[model samples]
Target: MKKPDLISELNTAINQNIIIEKNIKEIIDMSFKIFKKLFDEFGLELEKLCDFKYSSYYSKHKNIDLDLAIVKYFPKKDVKYKEFLEKILDTLKNLPYGYKIRKEQNDGYIAISQETSSKIINYRFIFLVRKKTKTGYCDYYNRNGIWQEDYALELTKSFSLANKISNGTLYKVKSLLNYVLKDQFKYNYGCDAILITWFYEFFSRSLNKYLDNKYNKKEKELDFVNFTKIKNLKKWFKYNIDINNLYYFIFTKIGETNTYYYPELSFEPLELFEGITRYSVNTNTFFKLPLSYFSHIKVFDLRNYQDVRLIQEMGGEEYGYSKKAWSKARDEDKRYFVSPFIISGPFNYAMFKKWYVLTSNSLFKTLPVEIKKDLNSLRQRESMEFLNMTGHNWISSYYAKLKYLQPYFDKKYPLIKERDLKVLIRMITTMVDKTKQSDWLLENDN
Candidate 1:
């Protein structure tokens, strides 16, 4: 079926608060302005030629809105990447919306060299969603105005700009077109024309959805994995591994079967960010890092932990003296028991700290030599980023990192009242700190 020519509808959609399908074409047309501006800057070399065969303009364009666009560059001879990246950033300063660089990423001495081989970076920038807004969202939002949550951050992932260097599925045509643009350049504009056709049939829905289906469905989706399922517990008895840092409990609701690791339900709530995927606007599929992979976790259900703790203290008093009292305590603390496995050998707290965002460091000093070596080896000196989402380094503790994401979370999901989010962050941070103190395996690190 042929899609309607929605140019005018798209224009209307652009000005409205809530965007609809009709507005897509207009947004794509507007995005080309960026392309043209870029071409004017780089097209000078190929001016003498009739046309250039290889180009990103052909492969990369708008996915839904300008939210997704390819911004690739190849500097002319003697032009350095530092000059290129900075110049492009300066261009963003001229836009009507606000554009700020992440302070932790590049600042001060700027030790990270811009000239390194092809760097594919995903940059995010904010824009004015409602014409009615008189101020940036952080300050205030007028009752009549609105913030366009979905379109706030425009995601731009770059490809290698280095010539003669293509990595993993990249082709020579993928390089920024420089020399031979007019006469000698490659003209294999293979699937360029079909982009619109493909957009209508397939890409109208984000591709990330397809990739997500086959994977572990964001490990957080499961209420709680069984307490026995973590990596090294089976060997605890045989190898004298310390398991006291592990907090054990089952979070269950009457008639409901979801198992939980902590008493509190949520600590770091998920949020959608602009610039990642399309349906992210329509779903809770935010926060690219899976909960299973997130280290330094603090159990949030404090009320239950306290109740269970009281039962534990009263019951363990008669462990050797009264079998009846001991049995009762075991049953009472069944849902929330502090881990009981005492590790006698050296526990590797240092390595765990280096690789994870753990709140407790007590286990690091006593870890065995072999485990310490493993943790040190998995240091992962580089950044850990995937699916266009990156972690924050501005925080001091593992839990603080999630706490710091509050503003971004509120901006992405406005219905979530800001006050509640703030409270949750604070509560979770406090609970985790306490959990670390209570679970400080050293009490039984024997």
Candidate 2:
């Protein structure tokens, strides 16, 4: 597509009023009631409101999906937090499901759920109230000195508990709520200060550069510019915002006119966290809140909005134990590899310690001497390297070691795909059944 044409298309796309999901009304109403009640009681002031809006989008496979969100932002206030939290808890606890409270940083979050019924899956009430003393001093402190940034506070709480809530379900639910809350509270607090600041600065300074000739079209005299410029917008915004490509899938999927462009908007939370990180809850009360929210709202295909590519990306290079295009992709230049093991040696032997036993005992008879000697020599060096890097190597470093062993498997076990080699290594290290993964390598050996 030509630059001007793409610009015109994007211009029209942004202006179009996409439909918000019908069932979302209930969720929005619930959120609004909570926001309003909290604002009134706590003295937090409301600044702006955005009812949910949507836009047209086409998938790589040419599918369509609806995107919807509403935002309610309020001005920064004195936020007389302690007394405010008491009243906030009082309001949520009285709701039918009864409320559960968890201490976060110096503040307390009260989460309440409505029991699953014919209509509602359940409702979750979450609050973060930081204590603001008359003195201008604020740090992460609870009863003790237990406070961190909001994200750090959430991470600390997520790991310190034990609950049956699966990480997959938690990630999905949290992703949705994070989006909603980000949009709603961004302007209110400091939720989107970075993005908004960058946007203003860009338009304020380089207003003409963004308003290039592409925006001039006979069909629409939009005071707005093209969304194609959104790419540059992303690049400039990154100076103030640090979002990763993995979580940028939400925006790319939302603005899907082309299969190519991926905008790195600074609006996602999961981008702020790594996938290896898990979310835990001390009590069922906190876990159930997120579960109830997602379970109740099932009108849309949750998977449709979810990108499997994103799952792989968020999991880092070792996700699914698949290694393809890593050789060239790994280096100081990219630094995409989870660790140096892909380039290290000893970690590989540890991964296949059992397989190494099988190789040394059974396959050594059939394998050539050079391959065996090379494997042993590389293993020793890499192991020492890994040990030097860290006092102790974890299970993950085994992936790096496994890749070095690949050449031995290739010359001796020529039938396996390089992709399958990585899978086999992960399976072996994970204690997966050899019989089941036998199909993964040396298929023609039998």
Candidate 3:
């Protein structure tokens, strides 16, 4: 598309309400008003409210259709948090654009929607919540003056924990997180201040850029005027952190025109997280929550919306793990990979690990001696550098389930599609047959 045409199309969308553009500063100001209301109503400490800054924004088309204006909140305790939630709901229920409650149990929502000739749509005002989990989420990364990297297996465990928390949240927990963050980040001094302040500023800035990229007709064009590429290590991570690409799928499958362009205030407890990041493939520059800047902060897909169906239908509570994506064992062989679903078509970190193991074991056998020696000499990172979409001759592994990459595979290894598929299937089959991956495969495989 021509540059002029693209701009004209974007302009037309805005004029027709097909697309809505805002000077991002306006978004920041409007979102703060919502936070201010929460702070005043809860009587939260003024200092903490000051700490809360505009972090990011996201819009989803699902049970709730709203723009989630994310703010960074730090709280000290759950002090009367439950009461604050009750009051907020009661107050909003009386307002003109307030959400109408859909489900009031542990999992439910209150939404504000527009009525059209065909039906009511453009739902917003979703407040999702969750019971405090015992997952490895470190409330304070340096609470006891211990750094995460110094401990054994601590880093990986933290990544795993982050993966768990970012999953979609149910209702009833949104108000608690929103109202309680003031206490979450208030600091005394020294390391506590360093960590907390670091957490607040990085996310406030990172998410700001990440949220602004929604305007691209194809990929989100980097708003260069607003975002700068990360070059300094002071705020950068010590190690490469993995980020989940699930939103790519959600947007492809569910995101539609008009439903999300206009900002309708929403309260989803889940995606508002401050630590998440989205690394750009087009540019090494990053845009996302800065949590990944911490070497130990690995991103995992938290498909929370997947759980709502089970929660609403049964409400009985006994259905348990039976409701998770991994609950169906039979579907693993055919339907597990999630990367192919993203607009970027990225693969999971696990798939890269699998390819490494398989190549070392058999795929590289008798490779001309020079090639074999040279390949073997490469480190894990070196090996992976040659495997990404931008990398040379990368194969479409069975794990990615990317039928779209079949042409690439066919061109590289003509007439071997069946063999490649079989080998890939065998790799996963052996994994399932030999290891205790039933749960891991269920939760993160997709």
Candidate 4:
């Protein structure tokens, strides 16, 4: 039997403004229906355990392909929540239709995808628990915000402990502390320290009052320049910082399950550091540290003489920090640590709209020559035909074509409005229809 023409079907779907198998509302409703059924099957009260929030799509267009629905489940003491969740996941996984379950720890979501011919719909759920404390109920979900002060104090205490462990070597302790906290506090790694500091400063200045002035002062004075000289920073960080004490503190306080890596020290290198020093925890054996153990430290920039010296001492010359190397590592880190596994349907549609704009602009000779050339290369008919012929789904086929064109579109027209793209698509579609008619007339007359 001959296969259905996927491109023709896709084009027809686009022309009718029906690119997705189901719209956002329908998809979300379907998800809830399925969840309700699952809950009923397990003799569970869905409403009692679960709450949901619908996040707006990226595009404001009514027919936007993607929507996000966050489902939060609060565990009760009487309920076997973990087993129930596992059962749900197992049922979903064993379904005949295509379903992907991704548990992302960082984002705190269990994303389940239901894929159709045209799109992959996502339902993201977060399981939250509240513990009874002396003051009140502590919501574990928002602990990062509530517990920032506690974390800062803990970190400060850890630093002091490290100083004592290093035989009162304050400089070494300060250098290593800076190295660990720099990524969390100053750098952009979505850590809690920056947020806590920002909130304190912003509110203090806005209200014309200092809230926790001591913390503000301490954070301000904790700059890298104040702790150690640029040259000696590397020496102290490498040789003098008590690795044993560092490991113990991190393992006990952060690395263990309870603290959730303590948002402040939650960078990937810390995970690597923990793994490297895992055996040393609660053991008398001293394992010789491998040179490669510090390899993940390259993600940090060579800040001053200290950073440069540290990198050099770690054989930076041999493992050159070229742009390509840095980019590769950064990309890997994003994939492993940052980027969400779930694809945003609305974002994908937005990308398609951008491509349409670029194509229309190129055809009408409005785009730059370089962009036109790139666009033409990406839209080569033979390549697209080949991809469609290979049984690739519409999402895969669209992205395969887009993989090359997207960079150019992003670089050139980063802020192309949705309304403008829609207008252009309509105009381009009308123009193409006229062009086809004219060609048909000419061919008939000939």
Encode model 3's per-residue lDDT on 1-446: one tens digit a residue: 43232222322322332111253334434533654475456443211111111111111122212222111134444324344446546655543453244522231223344433333332222221212333222221111222121111222222222223222110111111222221111111111111222232233333333333343223434434233233322122212111112212221221111111111111112111113232223321111111111221111122334433433342211211222222321243212111100001111112222224443334344244554344446443443233222111112121122121223223234433343333433343344335432222223211
Give per-model CA RMSD. Answer: 27.7, 21.1, 25.3, 24.0
Q: Rate the local accuracy (lDDT) of all candidates.
A: 0.23, 0.26, 0.25, 0.30
lDDT tens string, model 4, 258-351? 1111112122222211112121232212211111100111223333455445334432222222233224334543211100000001111121
Against the true structure, candidate 2 reaches a TM-score of: 0.27
lDDT of 1: 0.23
Backbone Cα, N, C clashes tallied per candidate: 18, 11, 18, 0
- Comparing candidate 2 with candidate 3, which one achieves the higher TM-score? 2
Worst 10 residues of 3 by lDDT: 337-346
> Which candidate would rank higher by lDDT, 1 or 2?
2
Candidate 2 stretches with Cα past 4 Å from truth are 1-20, 38-84, 96-108, 114-198, 208-446
Model 1 over residues 32-95: C-alpha lDDT tens digits? 3543464356431111100111222221212111112112322223233345345545554453
TM-score of 4: 0.26
**2 against 4, candidate with superior TM-score:** 2
Q: What order do you get sorting by TM-score, best first?
A: 2, 4, 3, 1
Query: Model 3 segments beyond 4 Å from truth?
Result: 1-64, 67-77, 97-99, 108-446
How many angstroms is residue 185 displaced in model 1 relative to the true structure, after the best TM-score fit?
36
Residue 128 lDDT, candidate 3, scale 0-100: 18
